[model samples]
Target: MLRASLLASVAATPFFITAATAQDYFDIGEIIVSGGLSPIEANAFGRASNVITAQEIERRGLTTVQDALRALPGVSVNGSSNSFTQVRIRGGESGHTLILIDGVEAAGGDGEYVLSGLQTANIERIEVLRGPQSVYYGSNASTGVINIITRKGAIGDTYTATLEVGAATTATAFVSRRTERGGVALSFSHLDDRGYDQSGDGGEKDGLERTTINLSGDYLLTDDWKVGFTLRGSDEEADTDPSPFGATDADSYVVDDPDEFSTRDERTASIYTEYEMMGGRLTHRLSFNKTKYKSTYSSGLPVTRESEAVKYRLSYGLDGRTVADTDHLLSLLVENKKDSSDDNPLYAREATSVALEYRGSFANGLDVQAGARFDDNTVFEDATTWNVGLSYQIPDTGVRLHASAGVGVVNPSYFELYADAYGYSGNPNLTPERNESFDIGAEFAILDGRGSFDVTYFNETLIDEITDVATGPGAFSFVNQAGKSDRQGVEVSGNIQATDALNLRLAYTYLDAKNPDGSVEIRRPRHELALGATLDTFGGRGSVSGDIRHVSGNYDSQFWQWPAPTVELPSYTTVNVAAQYELSDTITLNGRITNLFDDDAVDAWGFASRGRAAYVGISAKF
Candidate 1:
């Protein structure tokens, strides 16, 4: 019923009476840290999660980070080449989604992550935790978890800069400070794109380049103690178009060369410390992290290949409280990783993890969550994950109900357990790739603070799953897949503040991914939609926004489609618009238009998507 005609068109609008402020952010301070046994409220998280603040990415003029996650709700993103952007959750596998920046372990090159060079300078919000987070993020996260939070300062000193131009060219700078105790932030971003000829029969013009830097700092020794630091870096390049340009057969998608390219040289760093004495409700945190990924490939002949990966992490967290409503959290982790090529070190792995969480909060409001994890991998066996969640609260009818059950894990990378490539012989008894999931939801609240609506249903099961078995005259190995694989979905979202100056949002998803004999899952999509609105215009000094998207069309066949063919890929829609204006008190001006109606897309079945573009910018505050 298309979710009852989109909640009956948001209950037929008309709630415009203005004049009321303070009590939104979805009523009661949004907070979600993987949403389970600790930081709650993001509408009391018990399962589904999606939050993109920073004022909705500056009122939706969003620049990257996959276009602010394409308006949330079970996110799906195909390609636009930030070196091959691909992220899909709920329909899974874009390296099985798991990326965290502020919490370390920035998933990159090795696992899966390439969201269009991710440049959202000094970000300050983006938390989307949709499902089976391996009992709170442990091991490739099995389809969900993207927590990035930057910009740790705001209030006192500030500086900002921005520049934008035509078919992609952007520059940004930011500086920050906050006093009361501590804060610091710095950011830089640059992106260039000439993009848009990704084959489809055109020639050349498949460009992209990026540069980014971000940092955060903090210190506050007393008042319960604290210390922190974070750093991020990036350099990217992309230009690989050959999709159907020179393809004859061999299943229809090609890119052998034409000045091919690929590059990434990333870096991440972290340090942390936090403490609070029992009198302050016992809490602690300790951390250290490092990540470096490098990759390069060329297409000028003579084969140029380079690879590198380095990761190290150490973490600790504790939060305790045992009385009146209960609480508990304890997490410890350690990981050391490596993958290298030109200087040797082709293998190395070390791991240790532990988690235990419990949270109860009752007095009839009912809420309970449980968690467990124990992973100790050095290549295989010794894994255990768990999760359980429930949230009630229907008593007075504001309505809320939630449910969850989880288990997730993935471990087997480095070309999926070592690839020999020349002779194709590498399979170290492959393991880890387990997933089991569940979800249930409901939530509604309308017309008081304005509006809200929610829904969710999910199911998953995957086991072993490694895939690539065949050994004979043409060798092949790396096996595991021997059964179970499925995914189920339903998601609907809503929001309406409809008048204190207009705001609206919508989301939808209906998916069913498979492989237990019901194959068909390449590029995922099985219906998805997103709509948006925001307006404050003129009298409030100016603001306007727009968004629209629709997707449904997927299939590319996972290899060997020799005589099978039938790569159905045909649905698409896109529109975007944005605005901002202030021009005084420190000045501000912004603009955006992306694919405003250039519609004629393809997000993988042969790339090519991106048309009608425009952008303008100005911002200053110093």
Candidate 2:
């Protein structure tokens, strides 16, 4: 890793540069910040969640969701290419975070679901809930949940367009129209970078292209009922370019045939129906979705996968307001997935799961939520999991308190449970890992509602963890270990309206993350902090904002053996600033400067972050 002192001299030279015009650094509000879990709802629970609205996302001119989360606390984004983003949440593994598209599970292949091969144009809002949520979602919910809400058509005609350009000749163009009856949105984005080093696994420039299309229409079968369906598809291509280090970058460990790099195509179709009564107070929802994927690799490997899911839900409101607007929800889900390869038939899997839940509120301004889920795998015995939570608010002081406890179980994935070739064998005796956790938190508003403080403390115990035993220099075998791990941490965030036109946002996380055997988990940090503020002036027409983030040193891999026993990633903070100017009601100019200090920081051994980059964008609405 680069030292702080050396950053000064390295800052003198630019890492990468390309022509840039206007662009959006941020996207608008989405599901996490909308629905019942708005910023206000999150504040009432005192949980550690940061709500970045769609407007905020657009103002920052960011390219994707992964880019936006990179600026938040307790999140470490490590990946050189946009096609592969690895996010470590609260010291959890990269796949720990559950990502949802409009409340539907968006599973990943080989661990890319965190944020990869996806764009921000169709997203209407994004909600990021920190902490375990297996009670509602199910397995792979160890760390938190990221719910992305997409845009739907309105009654009238509306159109939005955007264009952006940056280093590596990266350019994005998106356009959409919402008509009275239906809507259609299409986007084409491409990134061609000389890359920090060589292209995927090979020393060559890297290139990626993604094209997305979405179509939806609703027909009012009756005044109280409606039906609609959506069709979505995406095609992506990426070239292998290896980073300086081992298999860290997208194209690390270059294969023999560079032309066979990587390519993927996907298609998803869904149908839904909704019925409402009592002026929309009571509702029934149902949907069926199917998706298929095809991929080709340079190593002469070909893959095909298919997934199908069906969901049903029912919700109702209390009869009278005197009962604190009590509401109830029940849902059921089932899924089937299959993976096939011409070279490896034993690597395929067939998985299934079902769940039920009950959630409501009391008249005393106290909230409670609970649920249970069961998963049956074709390869192992079935497992069940559950959790419960409660919250209360003091109106006079604007102080809200919340506490929750739960037990969660996770089933192994296709790659972890079935694969038995390539010099390694799958452990048929692997058992599901179980976790029990509890947490308490509070949030207070001060300075006449302009200032706020939020804090949460949590502890969890994990048992029967799954692990891999290396059998050879290039192969390993999977197995369930008779071990337990414990993690406890506290997260604190505060914001102040220092002035009418200025606001400050800051957050920090402290964790004691380790195994029962007293060994620190690899790649998990003990401390992480982020500080940022926005300066708005001239009646909201112009503003400037910047932030600094620091993460304590950590390991990069699980095995203790390394060039050094423990890789000290070190603690380094980078700054970002942006300014906006409104030229007219139809036109606005936005400019942003990232890595202001030009810190040549390297989180992984030989992978370095880009330094001193800028973009200018113009947005207009007709």
The candidate that achieves the highest lDDT relative to the unseen native structure: 1
Candidate with best TM-score: 2
lDDT of 2 by residue, 144-242 (tens): 767665555333444445544454444444444443223444444544433333232234444566666665555556655666666666677765433
Off by over 4 Å in 2: 1-48, 80-83, 108-110, 114-118, 153-155, 168-194, 198-207, 217-219, 243-266, 277-282, 293-300, 316-352, 470-476, 558-564
Report residue 324 deviation for candidate 2 (angstroms). 12
- Give candidate 1's whole-model lDDT: 0.68
Error at 508, model 1, angstroms: 28
Model 1 lDDT tens row, 1-622: 1132221111111010000111111221244644643355454457788877666788788888888897788888888442577888898788778887776656443446577768776576777887778766677888788877666545477787888878888888888776655667778888898776665456566778889888776666676676767788878878775454345553345443457887777787777665555544444555556666666544432211122222222212233442111233343333333323322245655566667766655667777777787877766677888877787878878888888878888877666567777557767778888889898989888887588888989988888888876788778878887888898989989999988999999998888888867777777888889999989878988798999988885666523344446576788889899898988878789899987889976776555666788989887767
Q: What lDDT does the true structure give each of the candidates?
A: 0.68, 0.58
TM-score, each model? 0.31, 0.82
RMSD of each candidate? 23.0, 9.8
Candidate 1 clashes: the total is 0
In model 1, pairs of residues that clash are none
